[model samples]
Each structure stands twice: as C-alpha cells, then as structure tokens.
Target chain A: MRIGVVTFPGSLDDVDAQRAVRVAGGDPVALWHGDHDLQGVDAVVLPGGFSYGDYLRCGAIARFAPVMSEVVDAAHHGLPVLGICNGFQILCESHLLPGALVRNDHQRFVCRDQRLRIEDATSAWTGSYAAGQEIVVPLKNGEGGYVADEATLDALEGEGHVVARYLGGNPNGSLRDIAGIRNAAGNVVGLMPHPEHAVEDLCGPGTDGLGFFTSALRALVG
Target chain B: MARVVVDVMLKPEILDPQGKAVHGALPRLGFGGISDVRQGKRFELEVEGEVTEERLAEVRQIAETLLSNPVIEDYAVRVEQ
Candidate 1:
C-alpha cells in the first residue's frame, strides 16, 4: 500500500513518518502542503512539527494550506488519515476532529516515553493491536493538551470513539487521559504522541509504533 | 480604509495554562484577590474599502471560521476607526 506523508513548512516528523511507513511494508509518498493533489495515495499521514511556526495557534495556519482541503475532503469520504502531534492540532483546526490542543497544563515542553492503552483496536489505523493493549511511544510537545466540551467528551466515550488513553499518567493534561481518538467512521485518527518516532528500536522507544502503519496496511488489504 | 479588531479567547470551560501561569506570577508580584485569568489572541485587519454592514458580517464569518476555534474558543469582532 502507498501512504502519503504531508510536509508543511515547519514539519519535522514527516521523514520519520515516511521511514515508519516504509518499515511497516508500505510505500511512502512525499506530499507538499501547497500542492492541490494527494497523488492518489491509499492513505495519508499528517506528521508532527511546528507547522507554519504554530502561528495563530498550533496547526491553525497550516490548516489553511491547499493540501488540507484535499485531505479534509478525502478524510470525510472514509479515506484513512492518521495525524500525529502537531498533525493532531491540524486535524482539530480543520474540523476533522472534535477537540482543540491547548498549552500543556504544566506550562513546559515535555518529552518522554509515554504509555498508552489501545482503547479501540477496531479503527483502521489500530487494527494491528489487540484491544486494551498497552504500548509506549515518544511523546513530545508544548501545546498538547486535549480539550473538548463536556457533552462531546461524553459522547466520545459513549460511542467507543476514544481510540487510546494514557496509561501511566497524563503527559499533557489531556482530558480523561485521552491520547487519541477516531472519527465516527473510524477512518480518521488524531493522537498527541509521536508514534513514528517509536517505529525503530535503534532510535526511539522500541518498535511499538509499527502497529499503526501495519494496521493501516491491513485496512487497505481487507 | 477601515480597521477591524477581533479578539479570540478560550471558552470558560477550557483550561488556560499560560493564563494560569501568569495568574500564579501575579501573586508573587504583589497583586491579590485576582480570581482568574484567561489568555486569548487579538487580530487587527485593515480593509481597503469602506466598512459596511456586509463587510462587518464578512469579518464575523472570518472570525468564526478561522480566527477562533468553535470547539474551544470564542471570538468578538468590532470596527476601530
């Protein structure tokens, strides 16, 4: 399968995302923010970074990039999309997801191996793992706090859309320890931690993150 | 030309870490009795033409769709001279 990784002006993890995709047995396609085309890739990954310098709000400015229009439209049609860290911010800004990422409650940039529980393994990007499985990946960000209205939060929990939850401790003060979530169709997902960084044992926290890519591959084949 | 100012702020239900930090520092600097502080953003736009009801409505739309996230923030728009 072919997975496209979009590169915004300040995107720092697109390369890692691409490498992870390759390692997971999918071809990686490089996509540009300003490009109107998605290059007809089977899936897309919005990698992490301080896109557009995180101006006007993290992912706020980058959400207006030409590429996002296509990404948003494609995502609505059940095209699998995974957003990591700043990419999570972009998804929220684009209204593809239901929450906003605010400054961390600790008021500092945090980096660590974050433990996360796979709450819903049925999502397209998480099928490689068993439900309730716990994994650790690199979590790094300053504005990673996840916030949503109370009703929305309740609905997310009620509907089984909360894809992952923080296991050890809340890294960025995310509400209810929500580490990731999926859309109603389970095709789109946005998460705060950097799973791409953990796909290789030589660099990051083991290879626990390879499940995301491999899961997407399974979704495409099935 | 008309200048439009837009103020965007997090919704009351949302936590503001930056604002909280500022509020924490306030007590250290001799300020007291401050209940809370919420942080926000302000944008100033200078329109090239006359400001009309239509233009103001457009500005409101821009503020709603872009300047502030409806999920966690609220925004207000006004004309400034």
Candidate 2:
C-alpha cells in the first residue's frame, strides 16, 4: 500500500509521518502543499506542524492550500485520510470534520505523552485497535482544544463517531476529553495527538501508534 | 477603491482563554470595572469597485467562508469610509 504525506510550508511532522508509513509496511509518497494532485496514493496523511506560522488561526490559512482542495475531494470519495495535531485543525477548518480547535483552555502550549482510549475502532485508521484499548502518544500543541455546539457534540456521540477519548486527563481541556474523531463515512479521521511520534519504541514512548498506519493499509488493500 | 472591514469573534458560549487572561490582567494593571474582554480578529479588505449590495454580499460570503469559521465564530462586515 502507498500512503501520501502532504507537506505544507510549515509542516514539521511530514517526515515522521512518512517514516511511520514505511514502518507499517507501506510506501510513503511525498505530496506538496502547492500541488493539487494527490500523486495517486491510496491514502493521505496530514502531518502536524504550525502551518503558515499559525497566523490568523491554527490551520486556518493552511486549509486554503492547493493540496487541500484535492484532499477534501478525495476524502469525500471515501479515501482514507488522517489529520494529526495541526493537521486536525486543518481538517476542521476545511470542514472535513465538525468542530474547531481553539487555544488550549489553559492558554499555554502543552507537550507530553497523552493516553487515549479507543472509543470506536472500526474506522479506516483505527481498525487495528480493539475497542476501549488505551495507547499513549505524544500530544503537543497550543490550539488543541476541541469545541462544537451541544447538538453537534451530541450527534457525534450518538453516532459513535468519536474515535478516541483522552484516558488519563484532558491535556488541552477538549470538550468531553475528545482526543480524536472520525467522519460519518469513517474515511476521514482528525486527532490532536501525534501518532507518528509514537510509532517506534526507541524514539518514542512506545510502538502503539503504528496501528494507525497499518490500519489504513489494511483498509485500502481490503 | 474601498476598504472593507471584517470583525470575527468567537461565539459567546465558547471559552476564550486569551480574553479571560486579558480580562484578568486589566484589574491588576489598575483598570477596574471592566466586566469582560473578548479577543477577536479584524480583516481589512480592499475592493477596487464601488460598494454595492452585490459587493457587500460577496464580501459577506468571503467573511463567512474564510475570514471566520462559522462553527465557533461570528463575523460582521462593513465598508469603511
């Protein structure tokens, strides 16, 4: 399987996402922000970083990147897409997912190993994990708080669209401790944590995050 | 040419930590009785054509789509003399 990782001007984790794809036994393709083409990859990953210097808003300007047009189209067509950290902010900004990520409620940047419980493991990017499984991944960001209207939050919960929930504590004060969520079609996922950082045990807290990449591969190949 | 100003702000229900921080600091700096401080964004757009109903509508669309996220924000647009 081939996974495409897009690099925006300020993307800091595209390389790490590519490495994670390779670790999961998939070919990693490099896609550029200015390009509208997806390079024919089976899936796409929007890596974390302060795109466009986090100006205007986090992920606000990056959502207008040329590549995002293609990503939005492909994602709606059932192409598996995962957005991590700032990437998640972009996804929400692009309207691929509901809600918005505002500044951390504590008004500070936070970085630490965050524990997340798998709420729904049936999505394209989470199929490898068992329901209720807890995994620790690096969570780092200033604008990581998730917020939406009560109706939207209720809908997301009622439909079981929440993919992961913070286990130990709400690091960024996200509503209901929502760490990650999947689209209604289950093709797109947006999460605040940095899964790519936890793909290897030597460089990270553990190898628990490899499952996200592997799960995408399985969904594409199957 | 006319300059169009767009002010975007988070909805009242959403939490504004920056605004809260500013509100807290005002009293410490000897500015009292300031009940609230809501931080927001301002966009100045230059339009080459005359400001008409059509132009204002277009600017409104831009404000809704790009200048502010409707999910958590509210925006108002106006032409500046």
Candidate 3:
C-alpha cells in the first residue's frame, strides 16, 4: 500500500513517519503542506512537528494549509488519516476530530515513553492489534491535552471512538487518560504519542509502535 | 459596523500548565477561593457588513489559521451589530 506523509514548514517528525511506513511494508510518499493534492495515496499521515513555528497557536496555522483541505475531504470519505502530536492539533483545528489539545498541566514540556492501551483495534487504523493491548511509544509535547464536553466524551466512549487509553500514568493530563481517539467511522485517528519514533530498535523506543503501522496495512489489505 | 468577539479556550484534553501553576500558587497568596483556571486567548474583529454565515466561516478560518490551535483549544464566535 502507498501512504503519504505531509511535510509542513516546521514538521520535525516527517522523516520518522516515512521510515515507519516503509518498515511496515508500504511505500511512503512525501507531500507538501502548500499542495492541495493527495497524490492518490490510499492513506495519509499528518506527521508531528511545530508547524509554522507553532505560531499564533500550535497546529492552528497548519490546519488551514492548502493540503489539509484535501485531507479533510478525503478523510470524510473514509480515507485513513493518522495525526501525531502537532498533527493531532491540526486535525482538531480542522474539526476532523473532536476536542482540543492544551498545554501540559504541569506547566512544562513532557517527554517520555508513554504506554497506551489499544481500546479498540477494530478501527481502520488499528485493526492489527487485539483490543485492550498495551504498547509503549514516545510522547513529547508542550500541548498534548485532549478535552471535550462531558456529553461528547460520553458519546465517544459509547460509540467506541476512544481508541486508546493512557497506561502507566497520564503523561499530559488528558481527560480520562485518553491517549488517542478515532472518528465515528474509525477511519481517522489522532494520537498524542509519537508511534513513528518507536517503530525501530536501532534508536528510540522498541518496535511496539509497529503495530499501528502494520495495523493500518491490514486495514488496507482487508 | 458590527463587532464580533471570539473566545478561544483549550479543550479539556490538553493540560494547561500555566493555568495549573497559577491555581497552585493562588493558595499561597492567601486567596484560596479560585477553584479552576485555564489560560486562553480572545479576539475582536470588525467586519464590513452583516455577519452572514459565509463571513462568519471566513472569520472562523482566519481564527483557526491565525488565532488558535484546534488540537489544544476550542473557539467560540459572538457577533454584535
């Protein structure tokens, strides 16, 4: 399968995301933020980084990039989109995903190997893993909080949209220890952790994140 | 001329360290009345005409692009004519 990774001006994790896609036995395409085209890729990734220097607000500027218009349209049609960190920020800004990410409650940037429970591996982006399976990946962000109203939160929980829950402890104080979530259709996912950085043993965390990439692959094949 | 006020706040998912720090310090300052505090921003813009849906949407796009982070914050727009 072919997967596209978008590169915004300040995207720091595009390379890692591409590497992970390759490691998952898929071809990776590099996409530019200013371009409104998806290059016909089956799946797309909004990689992590301080887009536009996190100016005005993190993920705020990049959410209006020309490319995201296409990403949003594609995502609505059941095209799989996975957003990591700042990428997740863009998704929320665009309203593709519900809720927002705020700064860490501790008033400092937090970085660590975060453990996450795969709450629903049946989603399009997480089909390879068993439900309730736990995996560890790197989490680094000054703004990684996830928030929504009580009613919305309950709906997400009831609809099986809360894709992952934080394990070990809440790294960024996300509501209810949520680490990731899927759209109602389960084709789109937004996660605060850097799974791409953990897909290899040569550096960073172990290959626990390989499941996410491989899971997307399975979704494509099936 | 019409005026619109936009209030942007971080969604509950994100941690507001700044808000928490202030909340933590308020008790030491002999003012323990504050229960919760979150820091966000507000925007005021003037528009040329009536606040149509299209105009509001354009402004929303501008706010999303220039004023707020959707990942961490939610924004509300209020207009007065």
Candidate 4:
C-alpha cells in the first residue's frame, strides 16, 4: 500500500512517519502542506510537530493549509486519515473530529513512554489490534489536554468512537484519560501520542506502534 | 481606515494553565485579592474602508471561524474608537 505523509512548515515528524510506513511494508509518499494534491495515496498520515510554529493555536493555523482542505474533503469521503500529536490538533481544528486540545493542565511540556489501551480496534487505522489491547508509545506535547462539552463527550463514549485511552495515568489531563479517538465513520483518527516514534524497538518504547501502520495496510487490502 | 479588535478567551469551564501560572505569580509580587486570571488573545485588524455594521458582522464571522475556536473559546469583536 502507498501512504502519504504531509509536511507542514514546522512539521518535525514527517520523516519518522514515512519511516514507520516503510517499516510496516508500505511505500511512503511525501506530501506538502501548501499543495492541494493528495498524490492519490491509499492513506495519509499527518505527522507530529509544531506546525506553523504552533502559531495562533496548535494546529489552528496549519488547519488552513491548502493540503488540509483536500484532507478534510477526502476524510469526509471515507479516506483513511491518521493524525498524530499536532496532527491530532489539526483534525479537531478542521472539525473532522470533535473536541479540542488545550494547554496541558500541569502547565508543562511532557515527554514519556505512554501506555494506551485500544478501546476500539475496528477503525481503519486500528484494525491490527484486538479490542482493549495495551501498547506503549512516546507521548510528547505542551498542549495535549483533550476537552469537549459534556454532551459530545457522552456521545463519543456512548457511540464507541473513542479509539484509545491512556493507561497508568493521564499524561496531559485529557478528559476521561482519552489518548486517541476516531470519527463516527471510523475512517479518521486523532491521537496525541507519537506512535511513529515507537515503531522501532531500537529507538523507542518498542515495536507496539507498528500495529497502527500495519493496521492501515490490512484495512486497505481488505 | 478603521481598526477592529477581537478578544478571544477560553471557555469558563475549561482550565487555563497559563492564566493559572500568572495568577499564582501575582501573590509573590505582592498583588493580592485577585480571584483569578484567565489569559486570552486580542487581535486588531485594520479595515481598508469605513467600519460599517456589515463590516462588523463580517469581522464577527472572522472572529468565530479564525480568531477563536468555538469548541474551546469565545470571542467578542468591536470597532476601536
């Protein structure tokens, strides 16, 4: 399968995302934020970073990038899209997903190997794991707190749209310890942790994150 | 040209860590009795022509869509004197 990784002006993990895609037995394509084209990739990953210098708001400005317009459109059309870290913020800002990420409640930037429970393994990007499986990946961010209105939160929980929940403890005080979530259609996912950074055992927590990329491939094949 | 100002603030229910930090520092600086501090952003836009009621409505639209995220924030727009 061919997966596209988009590079915004300040994206720091585009290369890592591409590497993870390659490690998962897929061809990786490079996409630019300023371009409107998706390059016809089977799937797309919005990598982590302080895109556009985290200006105005994290992922707020980057959400207006030309590529994001296409992404928003494609995502609505059931194209599989995974957003990591700032990418998660972009998804929320673009309204592809609900809620918003805010400043960490502790008022500090946190980096750690975070444990997460796969709450819903049925999404296009999470089909590799069984429901309730646990995995460890790197979580790093300043504004990673997830928040939304109570009704929306209830709906997300009631509808099984929550994809992952933080294990051990809430790293950024995200609401209900949510680490990641999927859209109602399950084609779009937004995650705070850096799974791409953990796909390699030599450099990260472990190879647990490989499932995310591999899952996309599996979904694409079937 | 007329200037329009938009002030954006986090929702009341949401926690404001930056504002909390500032609020915490105030006691050390001998400023007392301040119950809270909620940090927010203010944007000043220079409109090319007269600031009409229609223009203010447009600015309000911009404020809602771009200046602030409605999910987490609220914004108010007004013309500067």
Candidate 5:
C-alpha cells in the first residue's frame, strides 16, 4: 500500500514518519504543505513538529496549509489519516477531530515513553490491535493536554470514539486519561504522542508503534 | 463601535499541566494558602462601526470554528457596553 506523509514548514518528524511507513512494508510518499493534491496515496500522515514555530498557538497556523484541504477531503471519503503530536494539534485545529491541545499543566515539555491502551482498535489505523491492548510510544510536547466540555466528553465516551487511554499515570493531565481519538467515521486518527519514534527496536524502545502504520496498510488494501 | 472579551480554557477532562505546575509551585513559592490555579487564554477585540450583534456573533463563530478547538478548550464571549 502507498502512504503519503505531509511535510509542512517546521515539520520535524516527516522523514521519520515516512521511514516508519517503509518499515511497515508500505510505499511512502512525501507530500508538501503548499500542495493540495494527495498524489493518489492510500493513506496520509501528518507528522509531528513545531509547525509555524508554534506561534499563535500550536498547530493553529499549520491547519490552514493547502495540504489539509486534501487531507480533510480524503478523510471524509474514507481515506485513513494519522496525525502524531503537533500533527494531532493540526488535526484538531483543522476540525478533523473534535478538540484542542493546550500547554502541559506542568508548564514544561514532557518527553518520555508513554503507555497507552488501545481503547477502540476497530479504526482503520488501529485494526491490528485488540481492544485494551497496551503499547508504549514516545510522548513529547509542551501543549499535549486534551480537553473538551462534559457533554462532548460524554458523547466521545458514548460513541466509543476514544481510541487510546493512558495506561500508567497520566502524562499530561488529559481528561479521562485520553491520549488519542479517532474521528466519527473511524478513518482519521490523532494522538499527541510520537509513535514514529518508537517504530524500531533499535530506537531504545519496543516496536509497538509500527502496528499503527501496518494497520493502516492492511486497512487500505482490505 | 463595540467590543468583546473572549476566554478560552482546557476542558475539565483534559489535564492542564500549566495549571498543575503553577499549583505545585504555590507551596515552594511560600503561597501555601493557595489551593489551585488554572491557566487560560484571554482575548479582547475592539470592533468598530456596524456594532451589530451579528458582528459579535460572527467573531465568536470564528473563535470556535477557527480560533479555538472545542474539544480541548471552551470559549466565552461578552459584549462591551
């Protein structure tokens, strides 16, 4: 399967994202932020980074990139999109997902391996795992807190859109211990963690992050 | 002319590390009496001319659909006298 990884200005993890796709045995394509076209890829990833220097709020400016227009369109048409870290911020900023990321409650950037339980593994990007399976991925960000109103939180829980939850102590004080979520359509996924960085065993962690890419590949071919 | 104040905050379910850190620091800073501190963003807009309620409404919509994320934060608006 062919997966497209978008690179916006200040996107620090695009190359790592593309490499992760390759490691998952899918063809990786590099997409530009200024281009609105998808280049006919089966899936897309918005890699992590401090886009637009995190000015005016993280992911706020990058959400307006031309590539998001295509990402939004493709996500609606059932194409899978996975956004990591700052990419998750962009996803929320673009309204692809339903929330925002704010500064860490600790007021400092937290970087470490975070344990997350696969809450809903049926989404296109998570189908490889069983619900409640635990995996560890790198989490690094100053603005990684997840928030929403009580009613919307109820809706997310009621609909089972919550994809991943913190397994250990809450890393960033995310409400309900939420670490990730998928869109209502189940095609788009966003998480404020660095899964790409953990895709290789040589990277000082387990390769559990590779499942996300492989899951997307299988979903695309299926 | 008219104006508005916009306030945005992280949802209760989401952790507020900034707030938590500040709360944690109260004891170290010798402010043990303080119990909690939550950090948020405040925006004030100075609107001109038309001064219609619709204009204020439009600004709020922009804040939600564009300016802020409804999932992670909530926004509040108040009209100027």
Candidate 6:
C-alpha cells in the first residue's frame, strides 16, 4: 500500500509520519503543499506542524494551499486521510471535520505522553485497535483545545464519530475530553495527538501508536 | 485607495486564553474594575478601486471566509474614511 505524507512549508512531522508508514509495511510518498496533484496515493497523512507559520490561525493559511483543494476533494471521495495536530487543524479548517481547535486553556504549550482511549475503532485509520482500548502517545501543541456547539457535540457522541477520548485527565481543556474525531463516513479522521511520534519504542514512549499506521495499511489492503 | 477593516473575535461561548491572561494580570497591576477582556484580530484590506456597496459586500465575504472562522468566531467589516 502507498501512503502519502504531505509536507507544508512549516511541517514538522512529515518525515516522522513517512517513517511510521514505512514501519507499518507501506510505501511512503512525499507530497508538497504547493502542488495540486495527490500522486494517486491510496491514503494521505497530514503531519503536524506550524504550516504557513500558523498565521491568522493554526492551519488557516494551509487550508487554502494548492494541495489542500485536492485533499478536500479526495477526502470527500472516500480517500483515507489522517490529520495529526496541525493537520487536524487543517482538516477542521477545510471543513473535512467538525469543530475547531483553540489555544490551550492554560495559555501555554503542552508536550507530554498523553493517554487516549479508542472510542471508535472502526475508522479507516483506527481499525487495528479495539474499541475502549487505551494507548499513550505524544501530544504537543499550543492550540489544541477542541470545541463545538452542544448539538454538534451531542451528534458526534451519539453517532459514534468520536475516534478517541483523553484518558487519565483532560490536558488542554478539550470539550468532553475529545482527543480525536472522525467524519460521519469514518474515512477522514482528525487527531490532536501525534501517533506518528509514538510508533517506535526506542524514541517514543512506547509502540502504542503504531496501530494507526498499520490500520491504514490494513484498510487499504483488506 | 480605500481601506476596509475587519475585526474578528472569538464567539462569546469560546474561551480566549490570551484574553483571559490579560484580564488576570490587570488587577495585579492596579488596573482594577474591568470585568473581562477578550482579545481579537483586526485585518485591514486596501482596495485599489472606489469603495462601493458591492466592494463592501465583497469585503464582508472575505471577512466571513478568510478573516474569521464561522465555527468559532464572528467578524465585522466596515470601510474606513
């Protein structure tokens, strides 16, 4: 399977995401923000970063990037896309997912091994995990608080669209402790935590996040 | 050239940490009695042509689509003399 990792000008985790894809037995493709072509990859990963210097808002400028128009269209057509951190912000900005990520309620950058529970494991990016399973991954960001209206929140919860929920404690004051969420179709998922960072036991807290990449491979192959 | 200003603010329901931080430091610095503070962004756009009602509407569209995120923010647009 081939997975594409998009690198925006300020992307910080594109290489790591590609490595994770390779580690999961998938060929990794490097994609550019300035190019509109997707290179015909089966899956797309928007790595974490301060894209376009995070000007105006996090992921705001990148949302209008030449490549993003292609991503938005591909995502709607059932192309599996996983967005991490700033990638998640971009997905929300692109309207591929619901809600927004605001500045941390504490007004500071937070970097830690965050515990998350797999709330919905049936999504394209999370099928390798079992529902209700807990995993720890690196979570780092200044603007990571997730928020939405009551109706939308209730709908997300009621429809099983929430992919992950924070475990142990709410790190950034995200509503309902939502760490990640998937679109209604379950093909596009937006996660604040860095699953790519946790794919290796040597450099990461553990190999708890490898399932995300492997799940995409499985979704593509199976 | 005419200048159009757009003020973008987080919706009342959303928390503004930067704004709250400023609000927190006020009383400590003896600037008291202010109940709250909310920080927002102001964008000024320079139009090359005359500022017509149509242009103002276009600016409003820009404010709605680019200057602010409707999901979490509200924006006001006006032409400055």
Q: Over 4 Å off in model 6, which ranges? A: none
lDDT winner between candidates 1 and 3: 1
Q: Compose the digit string of candidate 5's lDDT tens values, residues A8-93.
A: 89999999999999999999999999997989999999999999899768988898888888888888899999999988998888
Residues forming the 10-long window of minimal summed lDDT in candidate 2 chain A: A167-176
Backbone clash tally (model 3): 12
How close is candidate 4 at the interface, in terms of C-alpha RMSD after superposing the true interface residues? 0.4
Ranked by lDDT, top first: 6, 4, 2, 1, 3, 5
Alpha-carbon runs more than 4 Å astray in model 4: none
Q: Each candidate's chain A: what TM-score? A: 0.99, 0.99, 0.98, 0.99, 0.98, 0.99
Interface RMSD of each: 0.8, 0.7, 3.3, 0.4, 3.0, 0.5
Per-residue lDDT, model 6, residue A141, is: 92
CA lDDT of each candidate? 0.94, 0.94, 0.87, 0.95, 0.86, 0.95
User: Please, what are the lDDT tens digits per residue for candidate 3 over residues A1-222?
Assistant: 999999999999999999999999999999999998999999999999999998876787898899999999999999999999998888888889898787776667998988889999878778888898888889999988788778878999998899889988788778999888999888899989998999889987799888888888888998
Tens digits of lDDT, candidate 3, B32-62: 7788988887888998878889999998897
Task: Name the runs in model 2 displaced over 4 angstroms.
Answer: none
Worst 10 residues of 6 chain A by lDDT: A195-204
Candidate 6 residue-wise lDDT, B1-81, digit = tens: 999999999999999999999999998999988999999999989999899999999999998888899999999888889
Give each prediction's root-mean-square deviation over alpha carbons.
Answer: 1.1, 0.9, 3.9, 0.7, 3.2, 0.7
Instruction: Please write out the lDDT profile of model 1 over residues A137-169, one tens digit for every residue.
Output: 999999998999889899999999999999877
Candidate 5, position A89, lDDT: 90
Report clashes for each candidate as comma-separated counts.
0, 0, 12, 0, 15, 0
Interface quality of candidate 5 as DockQ: 0.51
- The second chain of candidate 6 has a TM-score of 0.94
In model 1, what lDDT does residue A216 have?
99
Reference-based TM-score of each model: 0.97, 0.98, 0.83, 0.99, 0.83, 0.99
Candidate 2 C-alpha lDDT tens digits along A103-188: 99999999998899989999999999999999999999999999998899999999999999998778998999999999999999
